[model samples]
Target: MSMVEVQPGGASGMTMPAAPKRRTLPGWAIFVIGVVGVVGVLATTSYLTGEAALTSSSTMQNTVTLGMPILLAGLGGIWAERSGMINIGLEGMMILGTWGAAWGGLHGGPWVAVLSGAVFGALGGVLHAIATVTFGVNHIVSGVAINLLGAGIAKYLSTLIFAPLSSNPRDSPPIERFDTFSAQPLADWLGELEQDQRAVISDVAGLLRGLVTRVSPMLLITILLVVGTYLLLWHTRFGLRLRSCGENPVAAESLGVNVYLHKYVAVIVSGALAGIGGAALVLGSSPSIYSEGQTANRGFIGLAAMIFGNWRPGGTLAGAGLFGYADGLRLSAGPQTVHALLYAAVIAAGLVVIWQLWRRKWTTATLAAVGAVAVYALYYASDELPREFLPYTPHIITLVVLALAAQRLRPPAADGLPYRRGEGD
Candidate 1:
């Protein structure tokens, strides 16, 4: 017997023509283009404003350090979201991890501190899983509750445990921090190249020098985790099952995948990663110690990064780096450097307008044109931005990035949705 394929809302055996495929650049080409564009912008800004910090090694070093926590938190967000859970409580878990790391560092050492933070964060994950998966609590409500509780608990613990040592309720005693290493001959060679200041080559040298100089072991681990996450999620059988749960739990269940187990595991891992992020913030500081409000809402920033990256690991890293770069620029080079960046923004906006026009997106092109004009006018009008507003550079960048990327994002089908076993049946 022969079978005829039936088309939906059409006669039997009828098929629709396939749509034409859109041409797109390969990932590597896109990456190279982005890198070259960024380098060129920095070079131009530095030359225009005569601010060397715009392309300095120290600035890039600060960017890596500042971006690490955000990257970790973003990774945590990815883990949870990919498994069909929204983790707004990453901040809370990070708070808990900070306390745990401080306490562990004082009693044991850096490694112990790391372990303690992970365990504490995992506990928070367990609580969230119990509330949302088993008891059917709203994910947002549970996450908010976790945030409040985590903060409260951390404060109380700080008073009870750290007050005696530090004579302060908000700060813990100093703990030993991890050591950093630099590549010897390569670092020296790159430093020399950076000093020579030969346009793009020097800028590239400076960037590489910063990466190799004073590098923390944890930073290396973070990079490994990013690459590992990509491999695991896209390549592994277990990852496929977990992602399936997020995409369609009912379908996953029918296929003998344990959706609840996958979600629980994913969320727990999420908390652990966020916890590590907290530990990174603590450890990355001079005379590392936990302090109240030290997290500075980096957890939320990280969530935003995850969204901007469209839930991919590589994209998340880029988002984190962008935010980190904005923050590092302000902190390392001050307002003069930031003022110079306005020119970069103007150029970027102009490029966006051009690209939108090329794509025949009239409305988007018009918006980009308006934005570019406004930014250019501001650059022309001001010598420097107000110092008070300078601190909010990273947050402002986050909002801007999300707004631009919002239209392009494609989240998992069942993300943030409540799930129950056998509901589809």
Candidate 2:
């Protein structure tokens, strides 16, 4: 399913920062929980399946690959929302990024691919901005247009651009992807510990060893974006005004905040970030972009991450991590029927469990995060967990969750509102 943003107003007023003052879980707790959760799940699976001979490094590497793009996409969406614009074109931008990177990397260099993607991403954003910011077109309609354009272009161009697998040259790289490191040492023993769990523990451990999850520099870049965006949205003067425009454009215009400019910048920056996410995905994942319907529904997933984070960069980062981890588990485990169902249960139960724990303050975000992983581990071990519904069910659930969250939270009054010169205010 898609993770679209649901508008939850700022804690109080526009000036009131949306970032929470106290985390139920400390940063360290989150780190520890993530570590424990990953290791525990990997170990249990390895032992149960007797695939323990595989190295832990490889599994971790794979996990990082899956999570990195999700992280960036989520945060990129947050950046746009911070300034009061809703960019629903993340998937479109992602395709542009993918296509641009593939072409640039092949014809130019890897760095050229990255740069070209960024430029094209900005171009896509410009297309969106012209309609929504300058011409006062509906933001949703503009986004839909962008998505359609991206789909059409990707479909028509994939065959034209990509080299034939049967090319005369045998040893050439097909698409340009960046290689950051040799396998990290931490991956080996990270999930190898033996625990005393009775049912299917060994199978979990073996799977972890066999998995080859790569750690990307992109993860570090994503972290920086979170911190940097947090500072920009909450600490900077421009951020305050930008956010104000999103919440109430009339009030901002009354105060001379230039509503059109804010929307333009916000949307454009959103495009840039989304483009970066695409580049990271191509460089980090498999070579080149998907041919047709390549982006699938990630644009929607990104929107969900933005809403889940309340437009805060830090929260968005954590939210992205949650998604990334969930996606990685599928690769880490064996049968789709088994792991996918387990993942769905974790996703389904996640918000409920967090809300339950949150009601009593007994559940910290880290705990919620950890509990989510724990649920997946349990679901993975059992065959009776409704395997068939697992793979595709999460998509429907995600849409419902986002829509419901939208009901609970009021989006920026100007979410789909366009910005114009004299009339916008």
TM per candidate comes to 0.94, 0.70
lDDT of each: 0.89, 0.61
Write the residue-wise lDDT of candidate 1 on 1-425 in tens digits: 33446578766777555656779997567767877788888887777778888888899998998898899999999999998999999999999989999999999888888888888888888988899989989999999998998899999999999999999999999998888999999999999999997877787888889899999987987898898888888899999999998899999999999999999999999999898888888888777999999899999999999999899888898899899899888888888789888888988888888899998999999999999899889999999999998989999999988998999999988998999999989
Stretches of model 2 off by over 4 angstroms after superposition: 1-60, 159-173, 182-214, 288-290, 336-410, 422-425
What overall lDDT, based on C-alpha atoms, would model 2 receive against the true structure? 0.61
lDDT for each residue of candidate 2 in 1-425, tens digit (9 for 90 to 100): 32334445544332323454554786557656755654555444444444432223343455466555656667667667655666788778877876776667777766776777676677788898887776767777878888888766655566554536423221124565555553445335534442333344433543443343343456666668767877887789888898888777778888888877877787777777777776766776554543444455766777776776566655455555555544554455445323443454465456556666767655455565776788777865665434454454435545654654564455566666555556642
Please give the lDDT score at residue 332 for candidate 2.
54
Candidate 1 — worst ten consecutive residues by lDDT sum?
1-10
- All models, RMSD in angstroms: 3.0, 9.4
